[model samples]
Target: MDGTREMKDSKQLISNIQAQYPRLSKGQKLIAQYILSNYDKVAFMTACKLGETVGVSESTVVRFANALGYSGYPKLQDALQELIKNRLTTVQRVEMANEYSDDTTILNKVLKSDIDNIRGTLEEVDEKAFEEASNKLLNARKIYILGMRSSFTVAQYLGFYLDIILDSVHIIRMDMGDAFEQIVRINENDVVVAISFPRYSKKSFEVVSYAKEKGAHVISLTDSIFAPVASIADNVLLVKSNMASFVDSLVPALSISNALIISVGMKEKEEIKEHFDDLEKIWKMYSVYE
Candidate 1:
């Protein structure tokens, strides 16, 4: 179904604010105006900071988010961030980072944020979906993994280990030419693992669209349920990746990839031993490692 009907576009936030604008109190009106004028900036600001910047109380910002139908200020901020993620420039990202530069030491803050991301992801990840995706990988006739930009690293990591433990694994790369060229033979027996996070790559969505059209089983790993690829996926695994600075946080996503790899290995126990044994023989014969 592609979840298009269920998709929440940036328009939803804007329209919600506009629709309720006339009825808003003076304080809420200030927030609405500020958000409408400076969403990219506000996306990175905490509710308290946003309120202070606009000469309102912190509670006003919370109520304003609630009035717009968001569950809380963080959700509202997240929605705003989603709207700008794909469009934000490096300079804009750096500017946003400057807002919190003095909060704590860079090293400590970054590490703590990653810890929170993983902890949040662990709490929210759907167990049934993870198991189902694992089963698909185990049973697939052929497996194709796709990701672009920052996500490409994660795809490579997953593909590396899976190639050793499984048969017919293909990692899609668009470097030489069209990535589709590699997946041209994909069919119902094939499984496509698509990874994309905030500031998603359109190419990833294109690959998912093609896989779906060909009746391939599709599994998506993304930070949000509303992520574009989520609609078409047979199973969706959500990984938490709260924004911190100019760089996209991918540690949690990589951790999920590791979990997937280990799960597949556990299920097949003895089946993949011979594959590794033969590969080790080739490595030793060629002195691949000292």
Candidate 2:
């Protein structure tokens, strides 16, 4: 099938599998059960390995994929990977952590995973999109930053420096009880910088969707193009966060945010210098630091 058709048919892979369960043969049902229960593992497994795990022949797996309307097992695997990319939970992550035993050097594995994630992010990031996002922030009349859960740290970090150097920067805080109320004032002249990673918050997606509907330009910092936020974003910055343990790696995400902030500051050097100079005087007046 073509890309468009594949996307339309496989919008919800698990749902599709369940919907067709009744018609599936006994061997296909075995493959389906293994996949539904251990998708994280199946996403990375080869057809041969999966066949061995499910006690089915490699041809059986391929037949099952064909029955699901995919070109082959690889296509089905890709759908599975996309489905779980940003939805893995903490409990699921801990289960993943348990896969490594006492003999495994988990610290090195995690560090290596972060290195690979950063390298992959750099490789896949669209330079044109990055430049466009930076320009939007630099030119916007106001900037609104949004993030929740683990992503909150990245949003807060970016917002802090932006607040220092730019005018009218707002960090949408859930603690305030009415994040939507705060963003109701956003309009076409504003920009929303939304951050989200695996186990993405429904609220963050809804808020970003609302911002897009309000005609605000949205700059998404997320794991992949398949991310829900990416669907509505005017500009997307892809950052990889794959890790071996339960915790998602933030090192690469933070690097992207840092680069964006630095780029925006470089574009407004004169304004940044003046703002910092005024802040320095206020700091001295109050003896804010030694």
Candidate 3:
């Protein structure tokens, strides 16, 4: 893709969840705003140095990429590289990199930027919307988890934790074809917690769309209001997780998932008890309970 197409793709990842992203923390929000405003710069930075410049840990950079539906920092960089290589002339790209050359001052600047982002996120988060989404998870008959690439980790985590609290939590982490096949089992009583961030993986969106079509309630975690999954989502939880770097972070997104899991745990404490009771028997049989 040309630079314009690449930039458009980057924008699409974040814009798709813009409305919901503001619920993230101040630092995470800072990262999100930075990515949007300085995407051209980020198309080239290494994850480690990117985190340093953004005043966040390297893990945060990796998490940020995960937040955006990338498997990790390298994948986000690939997307950035695609944008940079196809979008800008070599000379122009070089000129742009020189403009934001990493410096000690970047730390302070990134901190201030994140603070601003957090404030904005706080202002934009829809409390009632989040509550309604959580309620949906608590009441749903089956909870289906959809995520791919970077999002797969979050989906797996949610599925594992939610399973302890409720029965029938399904996670699709393999091929897109397999995911499509699994959603066929969804029904009116099922709810899908679908996660897709920047570079918003096409497969993730497809799964959400499929689940919705099957009459499953969909909850989305994405970066922007216009996130592709939002339109089909029954509820959306947004996380602001941009920073001045190449990678997108997942801390905020994971935090959102954790919150939902906690809510489910609270609502179905008895189910958790039964789930653990069965697990203990397996643990003893496997010598894990010694």
Candidate 4:
């Protein structure tokens, strides 16, 4: 097989398993079911543990990997890890959390996972992409923000700050009956900042598609290049959101948003200062602050 084709095939682990399911032996089928259902745990499991969990011998696990075209068990495990790094659902994460519940240091372990996520995000970030996203936001005639479900909070936070320094900033709300209607007026002069995480919202992807059709520049903040939005985005900021529980970590996403906001603010310092000055006078007049 071609190297490129091999890489692509390896990434589609679930699909490969399903395609080969009919030919697998009873023991291999047991292993396949367990892996397909509990990939999060399987990704981090030792071959021995995996076999024990599925009621198969340790050697059976290695045989299963070879059956799947991997050189060995470790190679197969690597492919599983790659598949779930950004695509695990909240339920899957909760399953992972339960695995660590018996540990006396569960709290530390969870926090350590978050720290590693942030560290990995920073190390893999593309400097050129970050700068391009910031520049697009600063120069756009209008900016629209879109996020749904868990991602809504991040979008709202970005819009809240950007609203202060930039004119014509809008947050496209899903509750508006027709979210697409909100961006119908978008054009080449506008920019859309979209945020999405694992089990990504379908509505978010629709918004990006609509934005692209309207010729609006799109800056996406997502967990991986495999994210649907990343494929269509003019600029993508990858942030690692792996966590030990049902909840997705937003620390790194928030940090990236903060950087974008600050970068845009610095570029328009004089305008921002004027806006702040006007707001300060109103706050004083209305006694809005102590």
lDDT of 3 by residue, 3-120 (tens): 2233346546657336536665665566667777776777657787677777888788787766666666765764654444434544564465353556766666556546644553
- Candidate 1 segments whose C-alpha is farther than 4 A from its true place: 1-10, 100-104, 273-290
Candidate 4 segments exceeding 4 Å error: 1-39, 44-79, 85-90, 100-106
Tally clashing residue pairs in candidate 2. Answer: 1
Higher-ranked by lDDT: 1 or 2: 2
Candidate 1 has what TM-score?
0.85
TM-score of each: 0.85, 0.75, 0.60, 0.76
**Candidate number with the higher TM-score (2 or 4):** 4
Number of the predicted model whose TM-score against the real structure is largest:
1
The Cα local distance difference test for each model comes to: 0.85, 0.86, 0.69, 0.85
Q: Kindly report which residue stretches of model 2 are placed more than 4 angstroms away from their true locations once superposed.
A: 1-38, 42-80, 99-104
Q: After superposition, how far is residue 79 of candidate 2 from its true place, in Å?
A: 6.1
Candidate 1 lDDT over 1-290, as tens digits, reads 11222226444778778889999999999999999999988987889999999999999999998787676787787678667776777777777776455646777777877997898789778899999999999999999999988888999999999988898998898785798888889999999999998677778898789989999999999987668898789999988777657787799889989999999998888888877798899999999999
In model 4, what lDDT does residue 135 have?
91
Candidate 2, lDDT over the whole model: 0.86
Worst 10 residues of 3 by lDDT: 1-10
